[model samples]
Target chain A: MQPFLPVYAPLSDQQIKHIEDMADQVLAEVGVILQDDPISHEAMAAVGARIESDKVFTKGDDLRALIAQAPRQFTWYGQSPECDVVIGEKPLYAPTYGPPVVETHDENRHQATMADYEALVLLCDRSELLGTTGSLLTIPHDVPEEARPIAMARAHLEHSKKPMCGSIISEQALRDVAHEVGTDPSKCHLMHMINTTPPLVIQPNPLRCLRAAVELGQGNMVASYMMMGATAPVSIMGALAQGLAEIMVGLALTQIYRPGAPVVGGLFATPFEMQQMGPMFGSPQSQLVQIAGAQLVRRLGVPCRGDGMLSSSKLNDAQAGYEGAITLAASQLCQADFILHSIGWSEFGRSYNFDKCLADEALILSSI
Target chain B: MQPFLPVYAPLSDQQIKHIEDMADQVLAEVGVILQDDPISHEAMAAVGARIESDKVFTKGDDLRALIAQAPRQFTWYGQSPECDVVIGEKPLYAPTYGPPVVETHDENRHQATMADYEALVLLCDRSELLGTTGSLLTIPHDVPEEARPIAMARAHLEHSKKPMCGSIISEQALRDVAHEVGTDPSKCHLMHMINTTPPLVIQPNPLRCLRAAVELGQGNMVASYMMMGATAPVSIMGALAQGLAEIMVGLALTQIYRPGAPVVGGLFATPFEMQQMGPMFGSPQSQLVQIAGAQLVRRLGVPCRGDGMLSSSKLNDAQAGYEGAITLAASQLCQADFILHSIGWSEFGRSYNFDKCLADEALILSSI
Candidate 1:
């Protein structure tokens, strides 16, 4: 029931040099592809990157050469030997737990109540997962906005001793959860999915939240979610490269604003539709992009995050299981440092089925 | 890429009635114990179970009722769709790709091979994976006389697929690799794991090999793999049922007798040393049992096989990643039709390493 952290190999001398060299190249020659985000444009300009409108191109050789020198392994600390989980150059790791949101048989996706959150926390507390506990579902949608964060924090405080991660939509919510859970900002591992501002841009609010987590010395997860066929390029490889470029820009800002912030390079890239709103379910391109992109990020010596068991279907049936298993396993096998949507997660992170949760737990036990 | 066959809901109302009746009884009386394997014996037996020893208990209700009731979701026909993938209430169908085998890396420990017979098939062809192809290392030395069967069938066949599963020596291997590939069999969809027999259980005969696979037909894949730790129980349940019981009783016999059969049970239970060896790698428990057990058998309904990544260390690192991820994910998620070691593969399937694989793949995909 305790957290399961894996120990990663220390970066080899070559790998360390690779990270430093890649950083320098990324900073100097390998500029990012920025769109209308004023902050991104300004940041690239300040860094002396060649900027032409929204597209920033750097010296190809410098970027590629530096990237080649990046590290392939890194270490992660845990409360105990048992808590340690390694990233880069190892197998996958399972996330602690996600709360069940939708009751299995429900028609309408209801809000996750305090009781639901509590039960999810209990399940997570009793699971052998990695660093952060997840916001299993849409928590208590009916509760007053002011009381939500506090109610959510109470569950973490009472049920678990593991290093938990979460999202607070507002600055006030962040502080409220912090106080209720008795967490030292320096020790909090904050995680959130930061999607690219579609149609070319990075929004300021997400950037602000990321910066706050960084300043607090909390773990920051910057996810570059790209729908393969929609707002982004149709090519998977292209999408992956673009996503990496965006996140790298974000990561650079983190270091510049708050150096040595515990930032994890995150990518939630998956296939999308130009028409119907549906998940492609185990898009190999998505899986490949995630894996390859994670490798690219780790080349910079930072941990990376990936999605697992994520599907658009809203049920705990075969499609959910198939999609969940493939995506989750890919993330885990690739040795991702941080994993979101690890357990009891279904309907594309919408609702949670108890049976699915049990099934996910059984998988976690069998896998991690 | 070929379309995956799916398991469909039962057609006959009579079958539906039977399944519903079974579900009711199971919910009320045959409550499943999601605990370590040993404790579930009495509960399983209580359902009018026939105990063929601790390792081989078959509750008549568990097998007969469930087998008929089990739907084939995403199952394969003679190169076509065998059934429809039931999204929620129906059983999931997955394919098996590779055979279990170990590869040696610089002579430190025997690691499972990624380019084994079964593994390559999954990757090379349109299989869903590129699994751990074969199952023994230095077999030329370990089983000089027994090498022909593996070489002739499994290795030769599995090399022709796209995605596939891997092999597991310990429970950890299952967990680690599952996390890496983005899914674990036990948790995600229809997957399998093969628990082998103790020191030198198989006699290396052809009939036995055929029988093992044939008997494992749409039944349980809980293979019997005796280990040294807590898996070493006081009775047959302690010894056999702990891990190896599923294969010996549930899978092998089913597969050996019924080719292309579908079964849903398996295990990789092994034992600690009672006589000479001190938990050696690729011990008879790791090799002979799985090879000669139920994995190779052909089931009429569907294939039953268990898989996991095999690693020597307890944490995530290059050794863990290459040893676990490439081997296991290659088979289970990437290819195998029916698989087991889809996740939690590390330290030879003992402990779970959460998110390590997520980060590691960041490095694995530089080539892509």
Candidate 2:
């Protein structure tokens, strides 16, 4: 089935403009803090941005011009030529990322083992619905944390041909993956997750990953993972403006470092439930953020990332289905390009349940 | 909380007009048949509609003019003034209707007894979320099938003061409920489900109920329940147009019988799964029909009916969640009024699962 060409854009032009203006204000005034990343600071300085301590204050117009160097769309190569995927065209689905637990049945959660990870990779490989083989379906506790990224990359190369994301644990992890895959620099062969610390900060590790991945001629997805009411404001538009400012800093860094770098802007915002002091997923408020974020990112002239079936529900029950459907429907309606956590997400990114995955896939197939 | 005022319209004006044109063609040419109802046949003939046996062939414009007599909105009074509900202003939620089985836990289904029916009424009465008490959450096997409607109505009135839908089994059942409730003609005190037989026909029972309900100054919801690909064409727009034509016949009948009758137009279209020979609910295709139907009914100048949390899953699982959410979200997005089956529906309306009801209500509460 063809990707959705939405006739209804939820955000009005004026509303979109207000968000852009707010983001620009944050960029020029609040600025973005980059920790322990000299290359990024130097690049921003070269672009005539003012630097105070670790924060780089820049005109939004200059950042926009630099970000224009990035390609609007790019081809991501798989292990084989036939598996290549074109980003910024259709929603390229990938399975759950960064879950630490696993379950096959209700309330039967356990620490995710290497066996679980391999099983997920095998399951994802066999499904025609998923366009890319995602990293970190779960953190296999058996594997040492540092070596896990390399282990994952090797497994991707050894098992599946679909495009895979590199590890963001450290710059070396990304480099090792590139070497293991024998990545072709002339063409983008890998993608990596680079998250910005919320409320107006970019941590050192993500900064290094962004610069390193772009330099290696690979794609980067700059994700702003904010828990609203804690790291960001409780107001929907307020949190969105903060998220946009942070992502633009990362996107602009890619272009300033290397003209025409492949990058994706992602806004993964969920409300902070005060009662639990944790982030809530698959709420209607979050769905609105996804839809508006898609519209804003599209105007930013790059591919956007959205999550599928993100749920707070523990079981593969009615709660999970409704939450996941609304979230996925938001992405589908807005025509999001890169969809992460497309299925099998449970408990606010806590577990990867196999049964939930099958249920999600069924929903996807029926929709198509 | 305010109901959804959608800024995004899934259908273009041209598309909507195309459906309208198709419906008009069906009304003028193929027409609609009324079975064993001479009053309806005589009423159509009085309006200058050509009566060929039981079928009424009237120009679409004539039907539209007749439908104009019904109010765009109406107030449905509860037993007390404080519990009264205004239907066309917001999505007034009513629980699952017309299921013959009950399940409190997974795989523990049993025939619904009168005690189960009373328990549902008590559960609904205590809830602040449900706007009205709905009839036939499950059929009580202890009651005679012919007397079931009156029993259900008495249970609703004795337990809750909320507005309710009257029985649809027979005309006598409706009159009996009205007499028991001591319905006032000055106010719209009761509503009845008046379903149009699919593929351009209206059964005798529904016609009699519609006439009786309107004459007593009560409300009638004209629902077209079509199993697409079997009863109507398989295409989304085709099924939608056919549904629209059928509903128009029922709506026009209400107005012609009594000007300013309280009425709702409902389009309930689920695909007939060819393999199973059963209707499938909660598919994205059905959601589209719901959304488009909402927009069309708004143009026809009456409140629209939409089902909430309708699902085909036997368990309250992830399939139920996603399906329920997507279906409910469609109604929410379109700001549909008079929502029936707002929670606790399962297996194509076969059972009213109590757990699913709570799960579905949580979703509704969180959204609000």
Runs in model 2 deviating more than 4 A are A1-8, A104-115, A140-146, B1-8, B105-108
lDDT of 2 by residue, B261-305 (tens): 989999879989999999988888788888888888887788998
For model 1, residues A299-365, the per-residue Cα lDDT tens digits are: 6667777666665556654345445555665575456766766666665655676556666666555
- Chain B TM, per prediction: 0.33, 0.97
For each candidate, what is the lDDT? Answer: 0.44, 0.85
- Native contacts matched by each model: 0.00, 0.79
Indicate the fraction of true inter-chain contacts that candidate 1 also forms. Answer: 0.00
Clash number for every model?
Answer: 232, 7
TM-scores for all candidates?
A: 0.49, 0.95
The two-chain DockQ for each candidate, comma-separated, is: 0.03, 0.57
